[model samples]
Target: MVERLRGDWPALEHVLVIGEPSWDEFITTPWEDVRDPAVLPALRPDPNDVTLLIFTSGTTGEPKGVMHTHNTMVAANDPLPERLGTTPDSVFHMASTLAHLTGFLYGARLNVQNGATCVLQDVWDPVEFVDLVERHGITCTSAATPFLHDILRVPDLAERDLSSLTRFCCMGAPIPSAVVRQARERLPGLAVLGGWGQTEEGLVTLGIPGDPEDKIVETDGHPWPNMEVRVVDREGEVVPPRTEGALQVRGPFLFVGYAERLELTRELMVPADDGRGDWFDTGDLAHLDEDGYLRITGRTKDVIIRGGENVPVAYVENVLYEHPAVEAVAVVAVPDPRLQERACACVVLKPGASGFEFAEMQAHLAEKGVAKQYWPERLEVLDELPRTPSGKIQKFQLRAQVVDGPAG
Candidate 1:
């Protein structure tokens, strides 16, 4: 990251990087040669101009910078503020990283467009977070589901007057039905919404305000105005309402391609029937209800998200399997505020393997260039794992029995 930042200094008129850890690295360029430009509101670009360069979450490999134009970005944000009932009076707070599209749009752009005040904080500090809402009159906050879960766990949750927050939302991290009910009761005016999309695809789906708890918790809401979304099978054939298929979206908020990675971009965005539509495969297995509500079941990739960073799951699992103690293993996401999802490994130990503790497995993983970031906090060693008739590991069932424990 430091090397890339240093190499790109000449091209970057201005650069800002923020992380929790203090960095020893330094960059000093003479002001005379520095190319910093004045901050402005409006930007004029060519028809196919790139307004922002965003990188993918690096679920597969190194993150790729995906270029997006003003039209594409505006198309994504246009209906949101109004649809969400966020006006000039609304003050937005973002719990996620500024690097994310939703954070950039909700935290920065929406505030600019609506002339609403944006309160900025370095981390997702629930204590400071509650105070900020009270201090700034914040009416809207953007947060991944895990953040919401943590906020609910705060010791003084009921004591704090969080009357300012009208809505709390994020995508991918789902809010369970009971949790949604708890939020509605605890924060009466708060709308707990589930958004659906990825970095490659901009805002595609949303669970609207006043939606039924069953729909809100179980499924992603219907497509927004002018946004086209469909569920298709392996052969790209559109599937029936209740059938499981790969989710595809066709809309204005779509990306043309990933910068410097044409082949990858090609794989994501595919041609459609009308020749007027561009469909991006979401790589998520899901089924839509009769009402067009989309529910995500499993991810196609083996990306083990420990916090927000994508840790390859199969890669880590492979490393753990090398340890003699393990009979079978499953690594799934458990929520944490600091890291969006922390990896938790559940293992069925070999019958006679001794001195093969969880610590030993972690040490083995660290020795390999496996990136200790993928190591699990809550390691569960069981007698055996429950499996289906087909001999496939049912992770969701395991998750219910094991994964969703107290967040670290």
Candidate 2:
């Protein structure tokens, strides 16, 4: 990866390798040496000083580095220990990449801050996850929605003793209602909570234990402490509750700025009446309930317009997840000469399941009372959906495949 980027980022000076020997041309240092008491400095920096730069996942476009300050990072995770019910004896299991904000905050930082034991996994395997939970007595963990689906698909899930696993905070995508319902039926001790956030804003909202089942599955919980969320139309005016619009957020945890992209950062910010340039446009379509809970409808670019009608991709995907055969699913737009674009439900079936035809899918939609125009016109079965490391389905890849023609 370094070699591939060397040409474009020629100014890159040094590379430090952790857990592995550095290449001959670069600096080599032991991880333990950096932590030596003699070499450590007692330094106190300003809370506003930049502490980290986390890059966006770039599922929609190029990744940009988001800047976070010391104060912001602390504000981002301060509520986690109490919110997640993380006691000193609680064990945190992490399977997602730490490069992402969710993994960095909940997996690493929160564990250290809360004085909880952490179990790390280099790669995700459902069986291994169950084993680790059983062995370590893991009490809580967070991951993308797909991880939950994969865990549920483990053939021996019923045979495993996963009572130690109590809380699963799901992010990256909307939690399919069916997945939540099935998880409750299968693991009565577990609470599968939904959440919403991005690298630009750390943990904007999270579902808590004891929320109604409908709220846990349908909404992405209420906003984090001191964070304000608003739904607005194209004109930047606030919309009525329960109405879909662009989601905007402003809080102490919001990124300081995009690293070295001041102009681009300014464009994404909205001026607040309090003379603070705070509100950051999230580029997500969502609605706030009367009680201020959020339901992410879709991304601004992920929406599919079929014959001038908008198809709710997330809603459709959630409904399709209820089908017994679907192990995983993604609804993407397929270019259509007439309708501009049409909905295609790309599905991954369970090991021994079959008979998922386009007509059968249409019948299922009809049974669920989905509008005829919103029903997917085509069905594509694949071994798996293309996903980012954080387990977010890369819809752009599926759209590209559809435009380029079917793949074998």
Best candidate (score: TM-score): 2
Superposition TM-score, candidate 1 onto the true structure: 0.67
lDDT of 2 by residue, 291-368 (tens): 899999999999999989889988899899889888889888888899998888899998889658888888889999
Model 1: residues >4 Å from true position, as ranges?
A: 1-43, 302-408
- Cα lDDT, all candidates: 0.71, 0.87
Lowest lDDT block of 10, candidate 2:
23-32
Model 1 lDDT tens row, 1-408: 755787767665544454422221224444334544442224435656888888766443456787888878778878887668888778888766678776777777878877888887777677788888878888887766546756676778788888888888756444455557668877888888887776766778887888887788778666777788888988989999978777888788787778888898788876877876878887777788989887765566534565466665545565676565665677776666877677778777655777456677768877876766667777877666555321235566666666555432
Off by over 4 Å in 2: 1-43
Clash pairs of candidate 1? 307-339, 307-340, 307-341, 308-340
